[model samples]
Target: MTDSQDFSNLSNRRRMTALILLTLTVFAIGTAELLPMGLLLPIATETKVSISTTGMLVTGYALGVVIGGPVLSALAGRLPRKTVLSVFLLVFIIGSIVCTAAPSYGLLLAGRVISSLAHGTLFGMIVVTAKNLAQPGKEGKSIALVGSGLTVSVILGAPLGTLLGQHLGWRFPFLVISLLSAAALLGIMKQLPPLPRSKGGSLKGQLRIVSRPDFLLVLLITIFGTGGTFAGFTYITPILERITGFSSDSVTIILLVFGAGSLLGNIAGGSLADKRLVPTLFGGLILLAVSMAVFTWSSHSKAAAVISVFIWGVAAYSIIPALNMLVLNKAGDAQELASTLNISAFNLGNAIGAFIGGLVIDSTLGLAAVPWVASVVTLLGIVLAIWSVILEKNRKCDRLPEYPFENRTA
Candidate 1:
């Protein structure tokens, strides 16, 4: 074979391996990030705090992710993306071990922050890599597949970790997370191809996009879209225990149902976005709003709630791959920086949702009220989406550049 054809074959093999490694890495991160939710009750009891106070740990971790994501991406701007990803996974492993060994709540909190610092940067790098690996018109699907590790973790990891923690000790989840992260590190070392160094505008230049109208609108969508999911999910364990009357052991099963729905949604969203980006986002947001609204009533009926969780999963995660695609598409020349910042935006939304969910629960509204509020926020997100569409149309009519990713590649 000619040199070009040989290179093509090598590239295909390498990309496939990278995809599997990325998926495994995502699984590890997902378990670590979400394990706390399942163990919230035990954590609260052990730490001598209310669930709401313990919820701050969630907010704290997300805050760390937001802070760490862009800063790390910017700092690592000169390094190979693959190398940076490997280091970040190593950081995650260390953090997980620290969390597992922590003797106090404060130490555990610190460990969570450490792990979170790796979360956003790792996700940003993975998404970019997945985009590069994709064939033409397959970027969305590729991102979704890499991202599926997270959804599967939510469906499979959290429940199992939670069950193990509840049955053993609360720290067991962290130990499992640590092991998983180590495993991911091994896969990454074995499979990921050597990546070129990042090339982009200075940190200041990239940050300038914060003021751009299109970027801001998409950032808002990320905030609201992700925040809506957290508002319900952050408080999910309590809601299941109190409302659905599921025991600690049984909560895992319900979460599995939710995860299953989310995994399916993640795949569907990617494929659909590959075909038509805007319409898929619009539909996903609408479905999210409807499902969040139904969750309020569904919480009172186990059967309905189970079904609702499935739909809620779909709506919540479907927007993720779509949002990442949309932001990169809009950012034009600054795709990597924009992509990393979008991950930060998503984490910021997570922080917002957890805080809001806590405030609602601490108030007289009770746990069931959380989903209703989430539904309203999701409706507001729909407005943002519509506005974005309108703005894009006007911009296009005025001869502005849009769909910047149309000709863009990683």
Candidate 2:
């Protein structure tokens, strides 16, 4: 592989172009992973299953990502990142094709799982790829740019796919996804080049990060902090329509507001992350906790719901870039493993947060109580983040440990 410094030699235009393609690649992967959620009803209807059972298709995708991110990254540790990306994109494409033609619900679930296996690991590689190419002081911004694909998928792809499914049947959306992934595959093949991997790291050696209590604490924060977003967000449609008293017809407009907030918040957070990692993260979580509280109150008024959901979107995503940067820093020499593990942490949080919301609904608290439960959970994250920040500050009294990496500015 060429020296990592070769990245710095590329002009700004080329760098931006590469980032755009990577963003689209991630966008495609994200769209496939989430497209199932939008088609749950139609799928359940066609496959002779209950709606709740079809929802498990989403659980299957998240599980695939949780398992695939770290495992796939570890097993492919020896391969060039470019090759890893290529093969995973191919896997995603094949998975989508299978979903398009699946003869049964079981087969459709299998295809979603197959496609999702590429979700986290490929995203891990994409982050490292973008970070490696970034100019000094731009790493957070670049990472956020790549991460924006997921937000865009929620905003554009999933909704459009849902619309297509309603019009042309559920199978058609997967076929569309297959076409999109094929384009991403060609983009990966053409736009990305061979990238170096850690020279001395082994999967077993990388897993040693699990033994470090300090890093594990950080991961815990990542789980709850990011997961807190989903706690309320997982049911935004119902919350807006049912609790906020927005007519069911206004749900799409509210959704667009929320998606717009996510995109803006992601970029704003990334910019802030570049300036100040700890303070920015702390502030983001603080605002996130506040936003959740705001939503709790805002859900009673229609106009308030719109404004609050938009702010909630911004506060929710703003912390991610900094949070992710913290993980990479904590993982030290095992940046790739740590990065992917954060992905797992994220998925785990989503499941747990959703469960928390579900519990609130099942109990006397009811659906209107969802954001209240989520707010308390987010406060826990804020507390943990504060502890981590203070601990890092005290540790600064001693010499910081060495973090290995190839020289990138060469």
Candidate 3:
């Protein structure tokens, strides 16, 4: 009996280890996605292109994620999830290698697109894996813990890549991200447990949830809510220099400060969501809108702008984990596809925000106009969140699955 108990204990430990390692892969994916934002200037200089043209890298990557998320997740529906995740990370590694070696802007953009194609699928698989391993009544916190990796990457990866680009050159950042991607691939290969093929039915069954009102509402909330963050952040470096009067060398440090705030926000959002997911989502959206408005006004004052950036980082990120939980809870038994779709929604938000920001900057409105535009969009998101909350409050289910935990671990 003692030996049997010991074996069980060992199994639990191994699963936890695998979860942590998979979370690190989240970090790598997040790093690769955001690093280009900080390195865009150098990339543009090297390619002899305008900054507006360089912005295509971000737009293109986001488009790839939007296209790949649900499609790849559905296509891999019959395969072992662990195998799909491993292959996706390998794709990221290959793409990173191409990015590091690319001789022209066009080639680098292609590499980014290829790498991003794997983003949503990896995150979807990883989140489902995390859920399976979580203790009952703790799904939100568990998934949030894994998702926190992205926030951590923003805090560390973006700034580190920026400094590396400044000192070692732009190509070096991709090389470093490539190494991290390779590490993630090995970890997943060795540690990830096998996930069985879905017994729930075909891809059509999984996609049926997409037509639900809650899912559509949540997706819109994600698109507009997160879009608010990107509209300003896509141009943050320039804003820091042109508006805040910061030197090029100091921008990375400022970003680090923003990242620190995001780390705190991610953890806080997880905790709050575990207690009351709806209220947490509502509060986060409201705070985000208010913060963006202040950021628009504050950008001209260095001290105020720095403070606003920190606040913006916190408010913007605080909604991420909560939003994921909301969608998962709404999807009922079809959690995997819903989870994948949420990641796609986030990336879609990024693309929309970047495009709108570019439009405003290109017009006579200038970069300063981005924050106000973002603020209005965010306020609209707040309305959607409120509607979602009201819809759930009025929901008339005879049974609500006991909050998505009570039976998840099986």
lDDT of 1 by residue, 270-328 (tens): 99889888888988999999998988988888889889999999888898888989887
Model 3 gets an lDDT of 0.80
**lDDT of candidate 2 over 1-410, digit per residue (tens):** 32347587788887888888899988888887788788888899999999999998999899999988888888887787778888988988888998999999999989988988988888888877888878878888998999899999988989998999999999998998889878878877887766777567677778886548778888889889977888888877788887877777788888889899999999998888887787778888888888888888888998888888899889888988887888877776576778888888988999999988888889998888888779888888888877776676566546563431112210
Count clashing residue pairs in model 1.
Answer: 0
Cα lDDT computed for each candidate against the true fold: 0.82, 0.83, 0.80
Off by over 4 Å in 3: 1-12, 40-54, 103-107, 166-169, 361-369, 397-410
- By summed lDDT, which 10 consecutive residues of candidate 2 come out lowest? 401-410
Query: Can you give the TM-score per candidate against the true fold?
Result: 0.87, 0.95, 0.86
Top candidate on lDDT is: 2
| Candidate 3: worst-modelled 10 consecutive residues by lDDT | 401-410
In angstroms, give how far residue 122 of model 3 lies from its true place: 0.5
What's each prediction's clash count? 0, 0, 0
Off by over 4 Å in 2: 1-4, 400-410
lDDT of 2: 0.83
